[model samples]
Target: MKPKTSALTIAAIAIVLSYLLILAIQQYPTIYRRHVDPNSETEKLPYQTYLATFLLFTFDELVKGNFTGTILKLKELNQTYVPTSLKYIFERFRQLLNELTLKLDDTDSQLDYAEHLIYSGREDDAINPLKVAGYNLAESNITYSQLKSSAEEFTKSFMLPRTQFFQKIDSIQNLIENMYIRLQALLERIEFQKNLEETYLEIQVYPENVWVGSTITVEGKLYTRTQPLTQKNVILYFDGQKISETRTSSNGLFNYTIKVPYTYKPKANIIAKYLPVEDDSNKYKPTTSNTVQISLLYITPKVEAKVLGKPLPGKHFTLEGKVYAERILPYNQIKVSWLTSSITTQLENGTFKLTLKVPETISDGKYILKAEAPPSKIFAPTSTTLYVNVQRIPINLTL
Candidate 1:
């Protein structure tokens, strides 16, 4: 009775251990599924390491004479394990590739055995399995070499280069996309600014009525949105010709003096215009001032001089002249010059008279006298010449 009790107790312990092992096996799939975190690097655990651990655990249980526990451990491995790396999958594929010839031989042996059984008069048993075996052998005729060549060609043509190029293109696509976005924005802004034009310019000329061959002052200011525009070029045009150019000062002031050509038209058109400099931001377009009209005129004068009652040398006489223009008015302070001496006189009623003394060196012969009136502010130059005869004085002496 004592030995039997001890044996039953030992049997009870063994049953408990077997139950615990089965329970652990049932829980493994849940445990593995829950513990694998796809986001974590540790989830890339090497499959070989997992397989070795399972094998070592099974070996330990087998060494302890736990056959049931080992069997349960192997089942858990079969159910819950999955290979992750393409390297491992490709290795297993090669291994299966090596087994193809053995499978074909096995099919051939089955067909031969079926033929033998048919000859032995077991036709019913041979017919079904033989048909299946023959069908499988026909389909599996594709050789290992052919499969390997196809896989290598696919890798060379499609898989390897596609993978490398896709990775490199992923890096460059971000920069290209950013540049495209910025350029699109700039183009949109430029399109909106194509139809705007604005500017402010004012021009003036001193003495709007002018004469030919006379100087006139050109003054102007350039403004943009009520602000002074400095260092800008301004040009003056007269009768459709460029006459003078100047740059604006710090205060946006520009001035030029131009002499009206003598050949200008009766009415002259003058303009002051501004041109934007290169490399400058021309937010406002080039601008021009309003046109200014000026009237042109010419003034010319003439004069004549004569010596009256010049009969003897070293004698006093009268020299007279008249200065007149096309429309004779009171000509005041007309200049009269002769030889190295000059005198100023007024045209009294379009005529002028003055006293003159002939030089004592005169010698009873023909002589010439010239008088000139130089150009003045409003009149051109004029001159005249006169000829006269002088006689030597007779002298008496007593001894």
Candidate 2:
């Protein structure tokens, strides 16, 4: 019985040692992994794996009675040691937060621009900023109601009424400017009417058909609304040049004699101006009378006639001459006459040409050939005579 018991005990002890050896072998890899780097990617495991690892670590701390050390280790693993995937997620979240912050900064800048414009009395210019602000607010992740409410409060409290006030100021300024212009125009019109009603002047020059270098008498009268304007200065202008000046008499009539100057014009523009006497009262303004145009007749025109294309007896000859006046005159109505007979001829550029036939029955002697032109209303009558000698034909072959 002792040998059997010894054999059983030996078997039991052998079984026990073998099991312990197997168990020790199995725990070798786990203990080796636990001593590895703490910050390794495998250390950042899934939630369940981390919980098991944490419980194991906590159990070890309790066995060693390191309560504070276990708490610190747990905290370090949970909070400080972060996995690469979770770090990437946190980095992406930081980037989004930074992007949102930048967008908010942009919105704030736009709001600042709008606020500055509104404060500077440029409400009309704030529309673009406000629109951008609204768009950014819609795009933002923040609540729209607060920002929009603040902007609305600002508009209602200040911007609207301030804009209206500035518009009213501009309207008032424009109104004042228009009123000033209208008042100036009214004063001018009143002055014009007053001048028209208060002062009056009339002029008449005698010998309207006077020739150049002749004397002319200019008579005029000046009168007010009720009485004659006596002793007031009256001046006459011919062709925009001052010619004569005289004072009015008690009858308000004035006269001046002036010699006409040489001119090439067929008409004369005469104007009479009245200058009121200077007085302390600024009631009367200087006045100018109406223009009186007069006909200026020229002196007698000179005529020169010559026979052209040979002046043979009993032959046709051209009589051409130029009729010129002392001044420029219409030569279209000039009439030319030769002796008792008259031939009508058209003048070209103050020149006339006519064909004449010498009488064959006339004796061969010095005969008078005359060219006379009648008055052209502006020019006096003129005549030119030329004597031509005709030779008698020695061979008389007549029936």
Candidate 3:
């Protein structure tokens, strides 16, 4: 009886162990879903862990200067539903990142502006933009430090190791520092250049008004701070064309005589420029004198005429005259006209003599005679009038 009872006890113990093993196998899927499955609704990992992990990855991208990737990650994080406990941290991080982006963009924009101004030969104007960039960079540095500190604290709150995160922050900080140093150096160089002496060129032109083919004298001085700059080459430009080049004397005086070209315009501009070269290029800046305007005039011939002894009308009379001008007139004819008769004669050595016959039927009176020189390409038209005594053939019926 004792042996049979012991067997029954062993059999019951075996049956109980089998039932317990089957139950454990049946609950394996639920246990796995709760603790290990990432897609499970009831995940056991805290929400802060996921937030911290995502931030770490985003920071890694930023450290590599992958701004686009960092922005995408940030957008992804922002779109997700955040827990109430981590909402402030996420929002603060976003604000800090936005500020950092703005500051960096502003700094880059200002640097680009400075570069453009420098390339355009406005170095002095570039200084302002460079200064603005410097200010932005400084502010960016401060913001970056705040961002780094916030990230470190947020990660530390979750017991996350921050060695890698701190390294990324340090790298970004080093880049900013390098940029700042380079900008400061460039600013200092520009300021030094601004401190150099300024150069001035002054000019005076003689005989501001002249006819075509005439010469005018251009004189000027090149100096700095009232001190003369001798032996410098001065270039003279007339009507935007390079006409002549001259050198300054011991007293910084430069003189050039250039002939006025035949231009259709009534006025022409002349400018004197001094461009330093070789070693002197660094000592003085290039300068140009104030523009000098020259009045261009055509040669006007003066027609002087006289009637010999005031001849009577309707009779032959001699008209003598000369065409006086600054230049010799071309072999052109002069026209002499009376009330009813006209004659044309060539100018002989700028002088002309004409015989005119008054109308035989005219009454005795004082008449006018006119001599005119036609216009030419270089000479203007001119005319002269003289009064003549006209008598009707001295009619004397008694004689």
**Which parts of model 2 are misplaced by more than 4 Å?**
1-197, 300-399
User: TM-score of predicted model 1?
Assistant: 0.29
Candidate that scores best on TM-score: 3
Error of 2 at 100 (Å): 57
**Candidate 1 off by > 4 Å:** 1-231, 234-296, 328-330, 363-368, 374-377, 388-399
* Full ranking by TM-score: 3, 2, 1
Between candidates 1 and 3, name the one with more favorable TM-score: 3
lDDT of 3 by residue, 1-399 (tens): 999999999999999999999997784432544556555443332466676677678767765656667777777877766546666875787778767766765666777777545432356788888888888888988899889878865566555667866776677787677668767766665555465556778899989988877899998998889699999898898998989999999989988899887664688999887766788755666666889998988977899998885565546777888988988887468998888777789887888887777667777778888899887767777899987877654556884
Q: CA lDDT of 149 in candidate 3? A: 75
lDDT of each: 0.60, 0.60, 0.76
Q: Which stretches of candidate 3 lie over 4 Å from their true place?
A: 1-69, 157-159, 195-399
Query: Model 2, residue 12: what's the lDDT?
Result: 100
**Per-residue lDDT over 1-399 for candidate 2, one digit per residue giving the tens place of the 0 to 100 score:** 999999999999999999999997773322325667655524333354454355345435523434356445544544534456455443342233233334444555666676544422234565676667656545543432332333344323322343433333234234324433533443343344343435678888888877777878888888877888888888888887888898899988998887877654778988787654457124444456767787786777888878787555777778888877767755664455544576777778778888887776766777677777676554666788887666665787889
